[model samples]
Target: MTNNDPKTQYNGIILLTSYLQRVFVAETIYQRVKKGHLGIRYSEAKALLDETYTILPVVEKTKQLSVAQKAQLQLITEKTLALMKGYFKQMPLSFNDKLALVGSSLYGEQMMNNGVIRLGKLFNVEVNKDFHMRTQFYEDRTKMVDFLVNSIHHNEQPDVNLVKPIETWVVDILRQKDYVLADMNKISEMIGF
Candidate 1:
């Protein structure tokens, strides 16, 4: 990442942004936590990877701008690129601790079931090897979210037909027989920037 190349840096930014979008469903806690959002898709990943990744022109646009504008842009871009880097160094809870929290806590986000985030995990491999590296935050998806999207069948929506092995989590919660966000993932604490 220290290569100082614009395109390379933009690729990093794209991967980080996509990863964060898939994981938290929002960058900072302050952003709107959309509960039913389907999340990042494979095509979206490819589009994002291919689009706005040309940092050269954008950086060039700042050349004629005031020093303050350039400084601000630089600050924002640098911070965005480094967003998940801090979490990388944190000491992960022990294996036992992680196991204990698996079923009870808001650990990590679901990737495969909720969204095309499964592709986000493998975006680098599928698209470009230069995309970006995966972080520790993506290791295990402990918590499931997005009830309406993750649900196999809806009690209200009669058209929803699902096969065996996949039960209706939404229906389970409605009948008070299971747990859900109750749409609570919509709540977010404002990020202090």
Candidate 2:
């Protein structure tokens, strides 16, 4: 069957899971900024949050997704977006200002994961822990890309010297998973959590 066939909702779920993981990592970075531990600027954090909002719709389109899209959106809207709006209202962004934003972002992540789990249950597909681990590997690659982009934007040479090995490792892991999924003849086995 083709990749876009209905049975491949399993693959779609994996794609959605990966997207949520990126959002989760972005939230973590935002948390570090709020805690005075990182230098991520307010505008930068806002842009990341906005990007996440945009991606949420795409993630909500999974075929087996039974959770109300509105409910999922509401969770993030009430938590993450509200905090961002409140922070922007304040005169100066302070540590305390960031606390709400950080909390909201974290809560949003949990809500998203719960929604994914619910979707998996609806499809009788287990969301594997390996898939979760793969998300971290994907996040590592994302960080590498962000580092390269930032370096280039600052008129500095993008460092490729240390990235090759990591890239190879990530690609290998993904390929291994793809092979595992391809070999599975049953959806239950493919999604075995």
Q: lDDT for model 1, on a 0 to 1 scale? A: 0.30
* Local lDDT at 58 for model 2: 58
Clashing residue pairs for model 1: none
- lDDT for each of the candidates? 0.30, 0.42
If scored against the real structure, what TM-score would every candidate get? 0.25, 0.31
Off by over 4 Å in 2: 1-124, 166-193
Ten-residue stretch with the least lDDT total in model 1: 184-193
Global CA lDDT of candidate 2, please?
A: 0.42
For candidate 1, write residues 161-184 as lDDT tens digits.
321111333223224312222221
Flag clash pairs in model 2.
Answer: none
Over 1-193, each residue of candidate 2 has an lDDT whose tens digit, in order, gives: 4433433544443333333343344445444433343534344445545654464445445543234533443343334323333232233433223332333333333444554565566557688675455555545544554454345446575466634543444344334534423433332232222
Clashes of each: 0, 0
